[model samples]
Each structure stands twice: as structure tokens, then as C-alpha cells.
Target: MIDLRIRTARPDEATRVLVFWKEAAEGTSVTDDVDGVTRLISRDPEALILAESDGLLVGSVIAGYDGWRCSLYRLAVLPSHRRRGVSRALLEAAERRFAAVGGRRGDAMVLEANEQAHGAWAAAGYRKENHWRRWVKPFAGPSRPV
Candidate 1:
């Protein structure tokens, strides 16, 4: 919808991409940083895709497949462009990317408290598992490098 063109994000798309990620993950600690995101995108290169329409960036998704599992993160569609299937199209593109990388299935980590994200992920064919659990530990001030 809206004549979208989805492709791998370029090196210079950091600012807009940061805004998009912050908005998409509101209340979360995910900050938008051009250099940081650029590095992340450059790491896998093809996993980060951007969606543009009429020459304006409108949506983005970080899709990565590590042979064991296909993961999607930071899916964001600008408020003005929501509900026009922009996000859905971005999701489909990620699915295709996952398939291309030999991923047998797709997976994503939506903040459990974010119902809207859960709904969208479900709509995109992800199911919730009642038996699964996640673990986390926070370092006092800064997280150590993984």
C-alpha cells in the first residue's frame, strides 16, 4: 500500500531509522542512534530493510536469521502511514528474507506487555507459547559487552 519500495537500509538512514525505532518501541529503552544502527545494519547488511514511499522513509524492520532461528526486531511504521498495510508488507518482506537465508521458520521477541505488538505478530502468524520463559539480569549502571 501507498506504493512502497522495500530494500536493505543504507548507511545514511540513521536519523530517520532511530526515530522510527523509538516510536515503534515506545516506553522501551531502545534509543535511535545513527552510528549504532549503521553498525548493526552493516554487520549483517541485508537483514535491516527500510520501506519508502514517494521518496520518504516510512517503515523499517530488522530481520535476522542465524541458521538456528529467524528473528525479526524493531518493526516500525510511521504513525501517518499505519494501517495501510505498510507494516504488513514489511513483515512479508522479512519473511521472504528469512526464507532466502535458509530459515525454516520465523521468530520475534515482542515485549510481553505490548499487546499491540503481540497482536500484530500473531496476525503475522506467530503463536504465543505458554510454556516458554525468558531470563534477564540488569547490571547496575551499564550492561557489559556481550
Candidate 2:
């Protein structure tokens, strides 16, 4: 039997949450560090939920609702937790929260090149917005003299 507990992230548990975030995103993201993730979670713990099993954190999904739009991101489920219904449960929980807060709709900006994530999101009912084209400028951060 798979034992799972889902709850809103606590301020102090952001570190552990980021650990699972990096693991699930192993080769797919550039900003996979804890520092940036910690900053985001701290700003809104209510939008972040964690799934734990056997005292080990395994899944997480963050929802951000800014009145007009709601976004779901940083969704991750450890390898061991995949296909055990963790991801689905976590996603459903996120949707509920979004709805409760009057979020008009939910959106996820999945990398088009990441087929795995695309497939999962598609199966979970996310449709491609055909009108959108993503643009990225890596390391487009504050310039500092080295």
C-alpha cells in the first residue's frame, strides 16, 4: 500500500521541497538551484503543497494565482513516487486551491522540447495554446563584473 500525505508547505520545509524539485527536474531545467526556489516558496507558502510518503518528501506542485490568471509550475514527483497517483493527487489538490481562490483558469508553461513533460501535461488535460511562443535568454540576470 502506498501511504501518502499531502499538505501545504511550511516555511521551514522549503529546503526539503527544493531538494525534490531538483531531483525531478534533473536534466530538464537550468534554474534548478535551491536559492531561487527558496525565494519563490517563501513569498507564497499557501500556493505550494508537498506530498510525502514514509516520512520522505516525494512530490510537489506550486500554484500562483494573480487574479487574472493562475499558473501551475515546478511540479515534480520523485521516481519512486511516479505512477503511484502522487502526481495526480497533487495536481487535483492544486486545482482545488486555485478554484477556491477564484482563479479563472490554470496554466502550465511546459518546455516544448521536453517530450516527457509535454506528454504528462497533455494527458492531464493541458492543451497547447498554439498562439504562444516562448522566448528565453539564459543568464539574463543582473550583470556583475567578475
Candidate 3:
């Protein structure tokens, strides 16, 4: 419940964020490492949003816009900071940023196995698209086989 500061993360801080995610986030993405995250920041500086309380990292969300669709990823809050409006604040900031950039819809990438996140996303007015399925092909590095 402390005052939280939501801001964009610098590319140099990607390693710290990777460490934080390993601890706070439920699951990991193929690009969860320092180099990958650093690349993301380098490409789109505003996409990696961070939340800090008293200068300590507490929450994070990636709001990415590809000139059209808005996609949210890595919406994670520290275990101790859950239910403290940290995620909401991050999401609100991301939503505002998306709206400002002419994004009409926001899609979140969530793992189906992370049932705990289901309630949080639902409470924030997001629903799963049962009619659609994600198909991905990895050109480099680690990836889930399709």
C-alpha cells in the first residue's frame, strides 16, 4: 500500500529485472534473460514498464505496441506486494500509454497453467479468447515445440 512509482525501465537495468522476475513472476518466457530483455528495451524503450516502492523493484508489465495492436506481457508483482494495487497501477499506466498511442485493444499473454493470474486478469476486465489459439515458431534460441 505504499506509494508506488511506475516508470519505464532503462536498457541497462534489464539484468536486475530478470532477477526480479525469477523471484516474483510465476513463469518465464523464452526471452527472460538479460540479453533478450535488453534487446527488447533497446527496440522499444517504453514497452518495459516497472513499478518501484521506495526505490525497490516491486512490480512490472510490458506494454508493447506494434503500430496497431497493444500487447501486455510479464505482468508480475512481488509475492509480498500482491493485492496492494501494484498490478492495477502498472496496468493503468500501460493502458493510458496504449490509449495515448491510438491503440484500441489490449491483449495479455498469460499462461493457461497460471490459474492464480486468472482471477487477477478477470478482476481487471480481461477475458480469455477460447476460440483462438496461439501458434508460435522459434527461429532462434529456446522455444516450446509446436
Candidate 1, clashing residue pairs? none
Q: Write the per-residue lDDT of candidate 2 for residues 26-132, one digit (tens) a residue.
A: 34345445665566667776788888898888888878777788898877889866777777888889899998998878988676666777767877888889998
Q: List the residue pairs that clash in candidate 2.
A: none
Tell me the tens digit of each residue's lDDT in model 3 across 20-77: 9998997767787788899999999999999999999999999999998999999999
- The TM-scores of all predictions, comma-separated, are 0.84, 0.81, 0.95
Error of 3 at 25 (Å): 1.1
Q: Give the distance in Å from residue 57's predicted Cα in candidate 3 to where it truly belongs.
A: 0.5
Residues 1-146 of candidate 1 have per-residue lDDT tens digits of 68999999877877777776766554433224566688777788888888899988788888987679988877777778877888799899998888787888776766777777787788878898878776655443356321
Clashes by residue pair, model 3: none
Candidate 1 segments whose C-alpha is farther than 4 A from its true place? 27-32, 137-146
Candidates 1 and 2: which is better by TM-score? 1
Ranking by TM-score: 3, 1, 2
Residue 40, candidate 2: C-alpha displacement in angstroms: 2.6
lDDT of each: 0.77, 0.75, 0.91
**Superposition error at 81 for model 3 (Å):** 0.4
